[model samples]
Target: MDTVMQPDVLVIDDLQKHFGGLEIMRGVDLTIKQGERHALVGPNGAGKSTLFNLISGEHRPSGGRIYLRGQRISGLKPEQISRRGLTRSFQITNVFSRMSAFENIRIGVMARHGIRFNLYRRIKPMRAINDEAHALLQQVRLDHRADNLASDLTYSEQRALEIGMTLATGAEVILLDEPTAGMSRDETAYMVELIRQVTEGKTLMMVEHDMSVVFGLCDRISVLVYGRILATGTPEEIRSNQEVQSAYLGEEEEH
Candidate 1:
């Protein structure tokens, strides 16, 4: 009898990204197992967003490879990667601010169904899409504001709406870049719970600076500094690692 090793949902193998005159990412490697809440923590300018960009196909790696469930994805387009089960969210709010909450989610629902933006005829009459949009609103706890314009919602609500849009695409591996970046204490708490509920049974990887949010929500933590990974461990291990303390967390704690 042998134990079956679960395949990682995403793998960054010696990944590198560079500009013409300067290198940004240098031999960065990371593996995220299925169904784990993983966090990538680092200081500003450490290239956390750059890593996300490469993984999500917003930028191609200069060298090395990226794998989604062990399949090579280094050169694929963003939509292609997305269709393969990886989805990413930006730090800023990413919703249709002028549209109602329902409308914003409806667009995501269309994407999930492989509905192209050019097909207005098919989209206008889809009852199931409407139902799903309303259901997602409830799931994100935004049903009360389903008819409200996105601009009317508070900052935290907009973030929640952003998460709903992420989930609407039926993504199994989600990459969130600083979901709580500009949130206050209570707002972050609210969003932590919202993310937990929405991402159930899915693989989650996030880049975050909020230690409290990271410690509360993630099962594993990877510390990145100057475009390189310094350490990867459980929250407890990260909290006590001497090298990590000196290199990153110690500096963060002083603020």
Candidate 2:
């Protein structure tokens, strides 16, 4: 028998949301391919975050559906979605401020291994978790800060630590919200490389405002405006889309 493959890792169809009488997401639709880096960009309050919240199961949608590998996920919990190989990073730093970098990552590693409060099962497995935590810290270039408190590191280092936790989940489909939202040009460049390295061979969907990051890192771009996708294409195509340029990109440059 021949094997069939799932070409799309994520699918959003007619996704809508309502807060009282106000409509937030107006039947938005998007598709992300397996092992592809996709970007979602628009102005500041164009429902990007709302869409992410709906997909990540932070908020339930009023209508429509989301699918991961053809199975519906719109109504699933965040943990349930994560268990299905999808995970999300927040816009704000979400590390445990008082914990050491090593300890924070070890918690995530434990989550990945489904290690709950079972003391009898914890002894021998802890060494392996520690090793994995160190490896993840190295990948994010924060190994030197392993013993430091999360609150003690620079802003950039803290963001890198968050990425390490995301990796520790062992999620194959990752959703990142503004990974480089607040960074100097140099810091942005370093994060660009870290994101590229850590998310390699995994499906990634990022909502970002930085055009340079979008154009530089994403395989395809989806422009969301007024709670709907205006266009989806390669970098060059989106750049030249007169509709896209006039509706969003051109306006973004003026600021």
Candidate 3:
């Protein structure tokens, strides 16, 4: 007898926000296997961000369900979802500008270790947290700047630190929103490699605008337009898809 593998994650059915009576996400279904890298792409106003928000618990779904590892998670708070082994990084940098890079990552580690509210306990006594934080920094190649204030780091370096913070949370499913946004060509390339390394053996779902980054990193791509998923396929298929060309690539070419 052969055993069948279950999907590690499922967005069984989802209908997200509507603004002014316009549906942003009509009805969406998605499944992800363990260790899969899925990319979500769409034209502006297509609701890619909305979908991500729903998945990461940043926004409550207007309707439908979300499941992680076979457990329904729809309507859970963001922190609650994170504790269930899912984590996310935003399109904008969300770090403590006044804190040192090491300190910022330490906070993440503390949260993951369930020690964030321990006001009376000295952080210095948390050797395990310190070790994990340093390990995350090393994974993102920002360990050298661990003591630098997050605001003092260069744009690319700050992006790396942001990823490191996510890693510190010990998440199994990572949702990155434009991880390469605002980066130079060189920085983008470096970030691509770093993301690949950090996400190894994990399920990664990303909303990206850079086709190059999508093609380079994603194992599968889903296209969204006018609040509905237009298509889902491999990078090669997406590139050659006529519908995708007409809806997205063609527009980019014209600009």
| CA lDDT of each prediction against the hidden true structure | 0.89, 0.90, 0.86
- Which residue pairs in candidate 1 have backbone atoms (N, alpha carbon, C) closer than 3 angstroms, thus clashing? none
The clash numbers for all candidates, in the given order, read 0, 0, 0
lDDT of 1 by residue, 1-255 (tens): 010145678889999999996888999999988888999998888999999999999998999999998899998999999998899888989889999998888888878888875644766567989899889999999999998999999988898889998888889999998999888888889899999998989999999888999999999999999889999988999999999999898897798
What C-alpha RMSD separates each model from the true structure?
Answer: 2.4, 3.0, 2.6
The candidate that wins on lDDT is 2
Order the candidate numbers by TM-score, best to worst. 2, 1, 3
Q: Candidate 2 vs candidate 3: which has greater TM-score?
A: 2
Candidate 2 residues lying further than 4 Å off, grouped into runs, are 1-6, 121-125
Superposed model 1: Cα runs more than 4 Å off: 1-5, 117-124
Ordered from best to worst lDDT, the candidate numbers read: 2, 1, 3
Model 1 CA lDDT for position 102: 85
Error of 3 at 204 (Å): 0.5
Q: How accurate is candidate 1 locally (lDDT)?
A: 0.89
lDDT assessment of candidate 2: 0.90
Model 3: lowest-lDDT 10 consecutive positions: 1-10
lDDT of 2 by residue, 29-146 (tens): 8988888889999987799999999999999999999999999999999989988888888899999999999888888888788876767765445688889998999999999999
Which segments of candidate 3 are over 4 A away from where they belong?
A: 1-6
Can you write out model 3's per-residue Cα lDDT over 14-63, one digit (the tens) per residue? 56666668788888877776787889999998998888898888888888
